[model samples]
Target: MSVNRATMQGAFDLCELFQMGGVPSIIAGGAARDIYFGVRPKDIDVIICGISMETASEILAGAGIASTPFHIYNGAASDRLVGGFKLVGTDIDVCLYDCTDVSEAIDAFDFNLNQFVISGIHHGIDGAHVRFVGEIHWSTLAAVRKDFTPARHDKMQAKWLDLSWRRATGEAVEVPVGGLDGPY
Candidate 1:
């Protein structure tokens, strides 16, 4: 499916906010992967340099946008609901500069496909210049007939639970091959 025009701009607007704030930002996770597949992202994930909720709100507030502080993750720089951004369940993770870099954050992703970022915020740039970052892995282009990777690393479990839930709701996943590397 082609991406919706509104969603595309919404992603840009959300990510660009950090760029404008002098914090280099990258759009990561499922949205970045799904963009390559021409699918509308289920959610948007923007990883940015250290920024507090107060700072984010201040930025958005200047743009006449409204935001709500929602502490979804502990220790995160900010977890908020940004208004005027047309994304469903949008999340922005702020990594402190001293703690983590963008590449490190990408490496910590659960799956290979997820370990990518689209950085529109170029450093030492004058205007709002943007560009895609990282190379798409051969694995991401390949089908998932191989092993199942963890949907989350902290839990260290594959998507079995999520698939099972889908199954219960009559959306069972079918394995293309007879075997898979990890538990499915």
Candidate 2:
């Protein structure tokens, strides 16, 4: 399947935004991973390292984009919704970690984007792919595993719940696999 033109275009716009500023950004959440396999996320979540909160906000706000503040104002640089998604909900979240904090997290494990694999799914546009980016910070992943990971995992779980709800309502639909990682 091919990526939805609109969706892929938005992803490029997002990449361009960060590239212009020379910021190190990772396309996170389902969208990133989905890209490799040809699936488009309903929302995009991006992680930007080493950015100041003020600067992060300014960038997104300047673009006239809206974002959920939950990740922002929590010592994070910020999060922004670069564009809208029709299927997977694509939203980008930037977590600007201090240099010291990033170093500490990296030291905990030998991580890189290579550890991840891109898988396929039938969602949005056929053959649509998203960028999963990859896991790098073990410390942060470990800490988030306890809480945020569950919520992330819940994204996939909700699919099943949605299916069940649909069945109960006499609508038949098949649930798609979350991705190579099985949703978490």
Candidate 3:
């Protein structure tokens, strides 16, 4: 799959806006996975580290982007979200993490495929620049391309869960032999 130009442009716009506001952020989660597969993501997930929610809201509002408080519950805790906004018809979910750096934030993701991040937003006199943050596992690429669902980390249990859900859903799920250390 190839990236949808419109979808990527929207992500870049949001990243540029946050960068100008002095907030270091990255596009992670399912949005990054979609982009890797060249698919148009339904929404973009942006992760900001060591920033207050108030500051993030101010930055978005300054760009004429109004954001509403957004939350995601994992059945364990209520209100695990910070805020979300829309730009060019694409929903952008902003998450404020306690992480001190990008790698730490990436490590907190539930799924390997969702762990990849797109960061390093730079706008120069010539043009804008952005790139993926880490080296994705070859297995991750193969799994995505083959539509093979992998195990997800069970945060509460602190262990990996088998592909039971995928099997229940009739999806072809493959767990590489010896297991995977990171996103592949």
As a TM-score, model 1 comes out at 0.51
| Model 1, position 32: C-alpha lDDT score | 52
- RMSD to the true structure for each prediction, in A, is 12.1, 11.0, 10.7
CA-lDDT, candidates in order: 0.42, 0.40, 0.50
The weakest ten consecutive residues by lDDT in model 2 span 76-85
lDDT of 2 by residue, 132-160 (tens): 22344211222222223456455545543
Candidate 2, superposed: residue stretches over 4 Å from native: 1-3, 66-68, 72-184
Residue 80 of model 2 has an lDDT of 28
What would you estimate as the lDDT of candidate 2? 0.40
Query: Candidate 2 at residue 81, lDDT?
Result: 22
Q: Lowest summed-lDDT stretch of 10 residues in model 3?
A: 175-184
Summarize candidate 3's per-residue lDDT along 15-89 as a digit string, tens digits.
Answer: 677767677677776665444443455677777766776777788778777567654444222222334444434
lDDT of 1 by residue, 17-64 (tens): 767767656666565544433344555556654556566566766876
What's the true lDDT of residue 163 in model 1?
Answer: 26
Candidate 2 vs candidate 3, lDDT winner = 3
Quote the lDDT for 123 in model 2: 39
